[model samples]
Target: MRNLTTSTFSLSAFLQRTQGKKVVLIYPWSNLKTQFLSSYLDQAKDGILYYRVPGETVNLVDWIDGMLNEFRTVLGDKFGKKTSAALAERIPAHIGEALASDLGAVVKSETILYLDDLDQINFDDEFNHWAQAFVSALPEKLQLVISARMLSRHPWDHMVASGDAVVIGVETRKSAMAFTVDTDDRPQLECYAFGRGNILLNGKPVTTWEGTLPRTLAFFLIDHPLVTRDEIFHAFWPDLSVKDATNVFHVTKRKVNERVTSRIDDDKQYELTQYTSGFYVASEKLVRHYDVQEFQEAVQQALVASDDRREQLLYQRAIDLYRAPFLQTVNQPWANDRRDELRRLYAVALTGMGRIFLRKGEMNRALGFLSRAAREAPEREDVHRDVIRLYLEFGMIHEARQQYDVMEQALSSSMNLQPTKDSRALLESIKARS
Candidate 1:
């Protein structure tokens, strides 16, 4: 990996070498980062979607929306208001249809999607699904470059192994903390609690728990930080004596630590910490990460951001963190309430992001966020109302009325409720305008 064949990775050379392939996964050496690559891709005159996966968690819809913003940036006037609206309206289930329809005409001159900072991100079920469909359905001329800190369970290996992709590497000067797991490399620790449970350390799965106790302990620390032993005992083994629960807790914690840090140096391993309060928490300094923490932080940041643009971006960031329910398969007591709260917060973030876009005059983009919000929380009349208003604002009266009817039906059927007064007023205004 240290072999220095070139000073810098040449995109033109890479493309030329891998002829007729739409997807190219460039596994640059540990020294390589997005800073150098971003400059190279930004120079492309035709088109490019240079998205830096910023957080530990990313939602499929938010990821697609970020890409769409770039697609819109590159296509310019060709992707006008109506086209943008149409593209934004595409559901996550039909994102391929939306991308192909919007980009078919613009990808004639070698459009590229540079997904930077791949190691800092985790793919949820939606991301995995969209990525496969998006890549497979892409036009022959479109190219994709995924730059990650380390590789895990993404389909890049299959692409390379199947002779469908060309993997290139940069010369290693000093290895950065991140790299796409090479033939001999491995990720430090990657855990995904979004859909199904998956835990990887050193590129190996730690999903098979020694018992239910180990899984419970790991997830407890993930949701509740600095939890006291008493909290753990009461939550899981309340029926047992404190001494008994303490024994069980210590045993389970040790097993989880072993799984996470096996074959790794003690100094480098991110293990659980115990305080004088008998509270245990995961060390913050380690290479370990939690999707729930990432998602919550983004949402909190967005909530407090002062600038409109910053808030908009942060809100979208927060929305992206919620890919699935918190520890979807984990049915423990600690997981359930937090899962419901985050789900509610996710809906709020979606609604807020859409409203932000609406205020900025990006009607189509606003509609997209609102539409997703409505889908996420069908019972949230506020989201449905916003979608209807967005359609009316975009001069799509028919779409607005259609959405209103849908919302009305949903409210009546689901909750035995009717639209709120504000929503009824908005619909009346739309009718008046029509």
Candidate 2:
């Protein structure tokens, strides 16, 4: 159904995909972000400044100050002797623009500021505001390439919509320019709905879906253990009458099975999806493995895990399995609704990670996981409380206050509601003790 081509996630490939975008926000869930960048940096060794955020709190102002000093040392020859070495008492208000201009004037080509492992940086609203502003203020020749782990608290949706930014690894409808190995012997369909929807039939990649509707339906069926025929009609052909919808649904459903059966060279009879008791489900004859299914199962297992270590392992597995949102490219109401549910599960997985690490007395790891979870699930007041308490534990009084404000703002903005009275009490009590 597709070309047998090998597409490596190489440096040149990345450059070509991200050519015109000034701001590159690698989606947070991807494990490939750092690996792709690392190889890219190794190959394209010029015009790129890679700054790996330390595994601790990062003051934006301090980081910028330090960066500017490093820049002077590297590009010092471009500046005159008098301007080559100077330490400032305070960072200028318009540091991004000024630095962009100064650097733009001297550099022969465009420069990329690659901020990797952004999860390490404490997610305060003030810092987030500055980061967004800094990105917007960059010159044409200046680029802000941040890791996928960049906090969602920074609103870059507008930038992405305007074509000023591009989120890498979001498309998967076409052939991925590669060959998949048949590693697993079992005849199962591997539906990876994270990052993009990648389907592997019997360990061999299934590139084409015949049509979009077929692919969408396959994923939907794979997602739900069982669905009523009427529900499928509503999700796919809501506007059509029952008679017309049923006709269309049968055609689409047939197409899905055909596409999968076509991919397999065997003559073994298999039905991709089955209908029984007025419910459509994945066929018992055909094994199906959806990443989202496993991801949710892992979280569920973690909840009832017998031991802390096993619980921690299960949570980590779920967190790792959630490489991205469910069906990123699919924008239908059903897909969107499923994506929201998966994201909430992911948020739960993150919270579980934080709690497990907290039990282990790994405060920094616990704090990072909790902060990420807080941002992921803005309305998760319990997670927000954990972050606030963690900040207090670290003696970050100001940070704790800022985190509370973030929760208040998020709750107000998203749902037009306030934090629970208990949340307020916890912060106040913690502060009083501190």
Candidate 3:
């Protein structure tokens, strides 16, 4: 009989048991799916039933069919001919007559159905039906296990509501650290928290700096922790003369030293170390935390995934990982460049998301997402191009023309280049429509 309560520890123990029972393991994100499946398979008994849901391409029927075929292939090798064939054929109707008769004949043992990447399956009415059917079809001695990112408002939620399902929550806190400027001028201590809110320092509740200019500078320094003071001064005072900016930097450095240098050990270097022309913070000791690293890793992973399933999962993971803009409260020149880089990457991610939506025939959502991306990165001609193309495809002439104008101005001003042939053609097409 299935237990109605599930925890990671309990599930781990349950999977290790030799007694065979029907088990379903549902995985959400694709990146972790294979790793989890391999672990489970290691503990699985011989003749264990295994089913893998393909990436987003396969529909429910195909997914089910594929599972039965795989079961047949694996079970046929182990359980001999008769049992393998029976199990494969009865897979589709496991809870009905076939499984019942087969179990009666073969001293019913455990059947494990591992469903990796359950999140790929859209949680619609049809999915709920399939889930219910699959669960009810299991034998009396069967144990089912489903794992996904979250079951909230999902078909799995309904399963939990009913007595047959057990729900378990895994609290995975992304690692993060907070930095406070000590009187000693060193990035002395680190703070950790569950999320991106205020970071605690030495058991005292500390809020992230809120003032506009100071916060901006702080973020810039954090983003390019190794950036030279000259680079930062240039970024902040781009319109000012270099000599003037250097003078300001010297005064500013003195003020920062007065305020933050007291806590630093005389032997230890300051947070902003002196380089020949300017200063830089060492990357190693910066008081940052886990979420930032997680997001950066996810972004790199997504970029590597390109257009594959892993890429989609990585994009989602990155989105979830990013809580706020790079040092949301900070505005210094160092911060601006980092913020710009992040915004650029964010626009690219949005464009990728729009393409996925477009492939799914979700035209409205695709256009909306692309439009927002374009707006966020108005200076990016590529982003505008994407918006224009999507709008043209959707027959939104006015919107397309507006994007063309924005693109034209942005390219001319920011890049000192005209729109490309493709962009011009798109603009002409919209103009013709108008």
Provide TM-scores for the models.
Answer: 0.55, 0.56, 0.45
* lDDT, residue 349, candidate 1: 86
Q: List runs of model 2 lying over 4 Å from the truth.
A: 1-186, 266-269, 426-434
| lDDT of candidate 1 over 250-362, digit per residue (tens) | 88888877766663555555464445446565453333445555455445555655566556655765565566787787786667876777787788888888888877888
Candidate 3 clash total? Answer: 28
Best by lDDT: 2
As for TM-score, the candidate ahead, 2 or 3, is 2
Lowest lDDT block of 10, candidate 2: 171-180
Candidate 2 lDDT, 1-434, residue by residue in tens: 12212233466666766787878875442334423443444455576765555555366656665566666676674542222221142333345445555666666767687776577656666555555656666677777887633346346777788888876532121223321222234355667889778887655677787789888888888777578988888888889999999898888888877778777754765557777788876675544555665466567656765567556756776786787788899999999988888888889989988998999999999999999999889988889999998988888888888889999999999899998998889778667966
Report the lDDT tens digits of candidate 3 across residue range 165-284. 543211111111211111232142222211333332222333434333433343344445457655776677787788888776666655443333334444644443334335465333
Q: Is candidate 1 or candidate 2 better by TM-score?
A: 2
Span of 10 residues, lowest total lDDT, candidate 1: 172-181
Overall lDDT per candidate, in order of appearance: 0.63, 0.68, 0.51
